[model samples]
Each structure stands twice: as structure tokens, then as C-alpha cells.
Target: MAYEAKTKATDSSVLEFIENVESAKKREDAYQLVDIFTEVTGYEAKMWGPSIIGFGTYHYKYASGHEGDAPLAGFSPRKAKISLYFATEDTSREELLQQLGKHEAAKACVYINKVADINVAILKTLISQSVSFLQERYPNHN
Candidate 1:
């Protein structure tokens, strides 16, 4: 199957979605993320697709011609881990991750077993840096 982007903001209730998290621990972590992201970005949380909670917004068009809007920062509390979305292309991402506590990072996502396992201060820095990088690159964030 072709890849389809699953990260789009919807009118879905973020609070209700978090409430439905299967694990109590995950649900608590989701609430903490909402508070953290909101405080860091000064933007309200929005439900992205069925799983992700996102903050802020930015639009971009790639050289290959693809174009769309995406959240400046976001996270999803999956059954196994909480997936954090960040601008990993930023040069400082690696340095930040080194201090982020236990995490598994792919190209753009950081997977952590729980929020308690990570440094909240470093998470805030990551979110701030990602927003700054996106704002600089996209210039259409809000």
C-alpha cells in the first residue's frame, strides 16, 4: 500500500481521545504532554488523526512538489511507547536526544516508554527547537 499521511488536525476532542487511552499510564502521560506542549508552544492542543495530540501549525511545500500543513510538535501514546514528533533534521537534535533519557529515535519520531523516563526540560527544549526550525524553514506557522 502507498504511504498516506496520518497526521492532520481534526475537530476531534483531544481530551476525550486521551481519555480513551487503553493504559492508565499512557492516559496520564498524554495529559502531561498536553500541558507541556501547550506551555512550551503557547498553542492549544489539537487532535491529529485518531491518535496524536498536536500543538501549533505550519505549512510547507517540498522541492519534489508535495505540500501540506502539519503540527509544529506532537506526540502519540501508543500501546508500547509514546511517539514524539520533532524536526530531527535540526543539527542539535542529536545532542538534545543524548540528554533526553531513554528513547528510540527514527528519522522524525522519538519513542519513549514513558514521560517519567525522560527529562521534561529536555523535552521542552526539543519542542522549542523544532518550532523554531519549522518557523524558520516554513515561515507560515501559527
Candidate 2:
């Protein structure tokens, strides 16, 4: 199923949840991510779906016949780690990923536990690169 933001319910329970994490480190990581995303995307933070903090918007269709609208770029705070969604399983990001500090890649996203584990400069570059990629792919995304 596709994700939907409950616009009518702008509850910030997600922020509270992140703030109340058992570990101070994790909470700080979340805060840093929020700051980085805000600085780069220029979009105020908001919880999308359930655990994701999304930046921008983009509508996408998969070749496998699935179609949906999603954040142009976003991240999810999972139990074990954080997943940064950028490009899908395409090799277009291969070179960039190689320059990344430490991260795991999935079919459509990049996974990391903490911001300190990776280069903030590189992460910012990836965000910009991914946004550009999606914008070029979907010109009407704005």
C-alpha cells in the first residue's frame, strides 16, 4: 500500500517519540537528521507514513505495475537504524555511494544508524544529487 500523510492530523507525536528514545545518542541522531534535512531541503520537518521524516514530494510509478506518490526524499527511524531514501536500485548512484563514508544500500534507499558514522558533507551531496535526479526524472514534481 502507498503511504499517506494525515494532513488533518498534524500531531507531532513522532517528534515526541523521537525525543523520548531510550538512548540519548539516538535522540541526538534524530535531531541532527532533522536539522540536516531542513537545511538542505528547505522544508520544515513533518512525519510521513509513520516513522519517516519527509522533505519534499514526488509522484512515482514502478515498472512492475505499482504506482504511488512519495516524498521526493526522506528518512525513516527504524528500530535498528535509519533508512535514507534516495534513488532506487539503479546503478546511477553507484559512484556516489562509493564516496559515502559508511552506509548500506537497498533497492530504493540508503540505510545508516547514525549521522556521526557517515560524512555529513557527503550525505548532503547525496541529498542534492538525489533530488536533482528525481526532479529531472519527474519534471512536474514541484
lDDT on C-alpha atoms for all candidate structures: 0.90, 0.74
| Structural RMSD, model 1 | 2.2
Write one digit per residue (lDDT tens) for candidate 2, span 75-110: 877778888977633564787788777889877788
Q: What is the lDDT of residue 44 in candidate 2?
A: 70
lDDT of 2 at 125: 76
Best by lDDT: 1
TM-score of each: 0.94, 0.80
Backbone clash pairs for candidate 1 read none
Off by over 4 Å in 1: 1-5
Local error of candidate 1 at residue 130 (angstroms):
0.5
Question: Across residues 51-133, which tens digit of lDDT does each residue of candidate 1 receive?
Answer: 88889999988887777889999999998899999784656898999999999999979999999999999999999998888
* Angstrom error at residue 121, model 1: 0.5
Best by TM-score: 1
